[model samples]
Target chain A: MPNCRTVVPFSGTPEQEQKLREVIARYKGTQGPLMPILHEAQDIYGYLPEEVQATISEELDIPLAEIYGVSTFYSRFSLNPKGEVKVSVCLGTACYVKGAADVLAEVEAQLGCKAGSVTSDGKFSIDADRCVGACGLAPIMIVNGDVYGHMTVDRVAGILDSYRGEVE
Target chain B: MSENMINLKIDGVSVEVPAGSTVLQAALAAGVRIPTLCYMKDANELGSCRICVVEIKGGRGLAAACVYPAADGMEVFTNTEKVRASRRQTLELILSNHRMECPTCERNGDCELRRLAADMGIDSIRYEVEDLEPQLDESAPHLVRDNSKCILCRRCVAVCRKNQQVGVISAADRGFATHIESAFGRGLGEVSCVYCGQCVAACPTGALTLKRSIDAVRAAIDDPSKHVVVVPAPAVRVGLGDRFGMPVGESVQGKMVAALRRLGFDKVFDVDWAADVTIMEEGTELVGRIKAGEKMPMFTSCCPGWIKYMEHYHADMLDNLSSCRSPQQMMGGLVKTYYAEREGIAPEDIVVVSIMPCTAKKFEVSREEQRLENGCMPVDYSLTTRELSDMIAGAGIMFGLLPDEAFDPVLGDSTGAAVIFGASGGVMEAALRTAAVVLAGDDADVPLVFEDVRGMEGVKEAEYEVGGVKLRTCTVSGLANAEKVIRAMEAGEAAYDFIEVMACPGGCVNGAGQPMHSPFERMMTDVKGERAAGLYALDDSMPRRRSHENPEVKALYAEYLGEPCGHKAHHILHTEYVPRDTYNV
Candidate 1:
C-alpha cells in the first residue's frame, strides 16, 4: 500500500460514488458477485482505494477478507491508481527471446519507476505484459492503448518523452 | 427412498454402503483401512492429499478414495503394490517439505502426518525442502500458528469457514507461496476470531496448537505461598482417559480427581458445582425474560466462543444474551470470593486453575468483565484437557494406576444436572429441569429426560407447556448453524423462549482442545454421543437430578448468595456483554 502522505486523496465525485453503488446494487443477490462488482468498481473509480473496498464490503455484507483475497489474486485488478499515460511492454515468449527484458529495463529507466509503479507526477506508468498477441512484432510496447511494435532499447527515451510531453 | 445400498469389493472383501457414499466409506464398511490426511469426516472432503489413493480397475489412475463415489460391482484394491507405492510417494513428498521436528513437536505422538509416514515405511526423504521462512503467529492468546509444520492441507481453513462460519483463515498467495492466513497480513487476534480452537483440533499436525500455559501453571503449583485450587469441567473426565490409553468417552471422574490431587493442587474442586450454580442464574434470567416478553429468545451465554461471536457479529441481538457467566468463569469468580470466604483464605492467595475441554476458556478468563475489583483474574490459569494431561505426564503421575478419590468437600458437591453441561443441548436441558419447578410449583410434572433436545442435530427445537406458559426452546451447536438461527430470528422467523448455542459442533465433548479423534474413531463412532451418554448415565444414577434439588446448592444460597438472582449472586455470577468491532480496525 502507498503511504497516506503520498497517496492522492479520493477526489471521486458523487456521480462516481453513485455509479459504484449502482453497480453493486445491480449484482446484490447474485451468487458471488464480488468479481463483477469489483470490475465495475474499477471502471468507475479507475482503481480500488481502501474506502471503495470498505464500501463494497458493507454494501454486499461480505467480509473484507474475501474481497481483498479476490482483488489480490488476479493481475488485472489494480489496487494502485493508473497513470495518465500507461505503458505496456509485452514479455511473452517471442518478445522475451527478442530481448524484451532490455526494452523493459530501458523503459523503466526513462519513466524513473519500476514495472507496476506510477510516476510521482502521475503522468506515466510502466508494466510488462505476458502477451499482446503481437509476437510477429516481437519486442512490442503500447502507450495509451496505441501499439508501438518492433521496439528497441535506444528508442525508449524519445517514446516516453513523447507521452510525457503530451500529458503535461 | 428405499435404503439404497451399493455393493463394492475392497481387498477381495465384499462391502455395501449407502448409495452416493464415497469409496472410502465403502472400504471402511469392509473393514479395510485407508490412510487420509486432509479428510475430516463431514467437515472436510477436499481430497487434496492423495494419501487415501486406491487402485480402481479400469480407471485412468489411482483415484482419491475419499472423493470417488462407490459404484456397483466395482473392484477396489487398497493394499496392492502399485497403490502402496503411490501412497508411499505421496507421504514421502509431504515429508520432504514438512519440518521433521517430531520428537519436540506439540502433536508428536498424535500427528496424522507423522503416523502416515511411519505406517507407509517412509525411511527417508529423497527431496530437499526450500526452507520457507517460518512465521510463528502467537499473537492470539489461545492459539499459535507455525508455518514450518503446516502441510497446506487446508483442513483448518475448512473448519474455520464451513464449521465455524468465520472465514478469517484462507489460502493466501498461491502454490509454494501459499499458506493459511488471516486477511491482509493480520493475526488471528487482529481479526474477529472467537479463539474457539476448532481449527487447532482440525489440524493434522503441529502447525496450529494451543498457546501452552504449562510452565506458568507449574510455577504457580510450586509456589507454597500460592493456594492453587484446580477445577475440572465435567467433559474432562470423559476426555482425559483417552490420553491415558483408556477407551474413548469413559468417565474417569474419580480417577481424574485423584490425578489432580496427586499433581499437587491445594484443592481439587468440581466445575460441575459451578455448573449447577450457572443453572440457577441463567434459568432465573430466562424466566425473567419470558415474564417480560422482551428478548423472548434468551440465548445461553455459557459457550465463550458463541458469546464472543454474538458480541462481534450480532451486536443488535446483544440484549437476548443471558447475563449469566459461564460455568467455568462462575467457578473461578466464586472460588476467589465465596470459596475463599468459606475457607477463610484471602482471595488474593488463591490461584484458581481450571482444567477444561475448551480453548475459549483460556481467553474467557482474561475477558475484562470476568476480572475482580482488585484486577485479579478469577481464573489465573485456564488449561485444556491436553495441557492437564501433559502436566500429569510431566509430573510423572501414572494416571491409570492411581486409585480413585473424591474431590474436596465444600465446593465439590454437585447434582447430576451439573455434569451434563458438557454435552450439546445439555445446558438447555439442565435449565429446563430447574426452570419447570420455578415456573410451576415444587412438584411440577416435567419429564426428566427431554429426548427432544438430545442427540447431535445441528439445531433442535422443542415446545412444552409449563404452568400454562408454552415454553419454546431451541439448541444450536456450531457457529454456522447459530448464525442461521440468529438471522432467521432477526427476520422475525424463529421465535422461541430459550435458545442454546455451543461453538463446537457437539459442545465441550467435541471441543477443539479435546483429543483429536483418530481416522477410525472419526468415521465409525459417535464420539459425541458416547461422551454424552457417560454424563447422562451419571445423571440417572445420582440422587438429585435437578439443580434446585441439590442440598449443597440450597446450603450455598442460605450461607452466602441469599438467593438465585440476589445482589451477591448478580455481582459474582453475572457479567455484562459489550458490542465489539466486527473487523479489526
Candidate 2:
C-alpha cells in the first residue's frame, strides 16, 4: 500500500527510552519476543517510531527491516503516533456497501487528516478498520469508546465533536 | 536401497528420492521438469508463486511442487490440463502487476519470468492491471532498485538475510500493495547496506541492477586530454568469459586485455600487481602485530564490502582490520602517482579505470580517503564484469575471437600468489606464501601450499608454525560466517592471529557483478568453485608463485616505495576507517 500515513515527529521522553530498554532486557533472550516487545513499546510510546525500532533492532540484534516488515504487515501495529481521540470507520464488506466510504470522507474532511494518519493538531485520527465484528450495525462509526451505529455523512462531525478540545 | 529413501511416481516415471525430499526434488530425480519462479535451491524455496503446481492422484487439490513433500507411493502429474491452466493463470496474475517493458530491460534476454511465460505458451498478459507509479531508488553507488519491474520473488531478500546476514531489504505491506523495501522505505544509502550487490545478483528480473560506470569510463577514454588507464581485477579474467557464453572457468585474461587495449586505453595495467603490493603491506602489518602480540586477530582489508560492514556493524573491532588499501585502489594510487610521475604526465590527466568482479569496488573508489596526496582519486571509475562485457559488446568486439595480448610494463606483472587472490581463502594463502618466508628468514622449510584453508567452504581455520611461532588463522566468506567467527571471538570461544573475510560467498569469483546465470545452472553446477579452480590452475602455471618474488614489485620497492609498510608506502598504500552510524536517519 502507498504510505498515506504522515510521519508523526518523535517526541518520546528519556523515561520512555529507559522503560523500553528495561522491557527489551526482560524479553531479550525469550522465545518470539519481538511481538510482545513491540506490543509493550506501542503501549509505552503509542507508536513505533524509527528511533524505537532502531533501539529494538540493536537490543535484539534483529534487522530493523524485518521489524518494520512485521510492523507494517499487521493492522494493530501503528507506525505513527495515536491521536488523542481515535475515530474508526468499519470498511468491511457489510459496512462499505452501506456508504461507509462517505462516512469516512466526512470524518477526514472534519479532522483534516486521511485514514491511517493523525490530525496535524494531534487531537484526532481516522482509521478504516476491516471489521470491528459489528456487521449488524452496518456503517458504524466508533469514536473513543462510543459506537455510533447507522452512521451517516452528517453524523461524523457530531460524533467527532464530543471528543474535540477535551484534555487527556 | 537406503532406509531413508522413498519411492514416488512423477509424470508416470518412478523416482526414488530421500524420504524428506520435496516433490520438486522427486521430479528432478525422475527426469521431469517442474517450472519454478521463486525457488532458489537451498537459499529460497518459498513457493509463493504457484507456477510450480502439480496434480496428485487421489488428492483434494493441486499442490505447489516446490513446497509439497513427496510421500511414498504418491502419484504426481506435472503436466495435467488443470495444472497447466493453474500455472498459466498464476503467471498472468503475476504479470498483471508487473510493468512489461522487456525490450529495454537489463534482464531482457535472461529473465526467468519471460522465459517461463514463453515456455508455457503465454503470448500475452490476459489480466493486465494499471501500472503503479514507478519507484526508482538510485540512492546507493553500487546498485539501483526499479520497483516497477520487481516480481517479489524474494530471492534477493533471502540472499541478503540468510547468506549475507545483512537484512537490509524485506517485504512490506500486504497483498496487492506488497513490495520489497528497506527499513521504513529509506533509500539503501540510508541503511547499513554494504552494497555487495548480492541482491542484484539474486534478482531474477531487471528490478535490481548494477549502477553502470561504463559511460563514465567511455567519457574518460573519449576525452583526448585524459590519459585513461584500465586494470581488470584477478577474478574478472575467470568471470568475464561467462558473459560471452564461454565455460564458467575459462580464463580470458589475455583476450580481456586485448579488448581493453582496443577500447582505447592509454595503458592496460593489472590489479594483480597491486595485489602483490597489498601482500607486502598487509603481511608486514600482520607479522608486526604477531611479533608484538597485540590485536591478535587481524582482519583482511581487501574487500570493500567487508570494510564497510566492519565500519557499520563491528566498529569495536576496527583496530583489528588491516590498514592496507584494496588492490584496486592500490593500483589506482600507483597509476596516478608512480606511473604519472614516471611518464611525465600530470596526475589529474591520468584516469585509472578498474574492471572488477564486484559492485562494492564502485563504492570503494569513491571513498574520500582513497584520494591521493595530490587531491586526485586513485581510481576514476570502477566498472563491474557485466559492465565490461557490455562495453565490449557495445564496441562490436567479438570477445571470444579476440587475440591474446600482454599487459603494459612496470606495474602490470604479478606473481601466482596475486593471481590466486580471486578465491575466498586466497588472500590468506597469498600472505602466508610471503610472510612465512619473511618469518623463517627465507631459508627455513615452509610449505608453499596451505591445503587446509583451500576450498569453497563458508569458513576455514588452520594453525601453522612459522619461524617457531604458532599462528592461528581463520578464513571466511559470506558475512553470516564472519558474524559467527566475530561472535565467537567476542565470547572468548575462539582465538586467531589472522582472519580473512570476503563479503560475497566464494569470494570475487562468484561476485555479484560477475555474470547473471540461470537458476538451473546455479543449482546444477558449482560455478564459483569452477572459477576458483581456473584461478588455482593459473596460479600453479605461473613462473613465480610468491608475492615477495615478483621482479616488478621488487623493482617498485627498490626504486620508489622503499620498504614494505615503510613511511612512504604507508602514506600511499594504507588508509584508516571510521565508525559510521548504521541508520543514517
Candidate lDDT (C-alpha), each? 0.85, 0.89
Worst 10 residues of 2 chain B by lDDT: B125-134
Q: Give the B-chain TM-score of model 1.
A: 0.97
Scored against the true structure, residue B316 in model 1 reaches a CA lDDT of: 85
Colliding residue pairs in candidate 1? none
TM-scores of chain A, one for each prediction: 0.79, 0.79
Q: lDDT by residue for model 2 over A75-115, one digit each (tens)?
A: 77878776878888899999999999999988888877777
CAPRI accuracy category, model 2: medium
- Which number leads on TM-score? 2
Q: How would you encode candidate 1's per-residue C-alpha lDDT over B86-126 as one tens digit per residue?
A: 88888888877777677888999699887787888888777
Expressed as tens digits, the lDDT of each residue in B181-227 for candidate 2 is 89888889878999999999898888998899788888898999999
Residue A164 C-alpha lDDT in model 2:
65
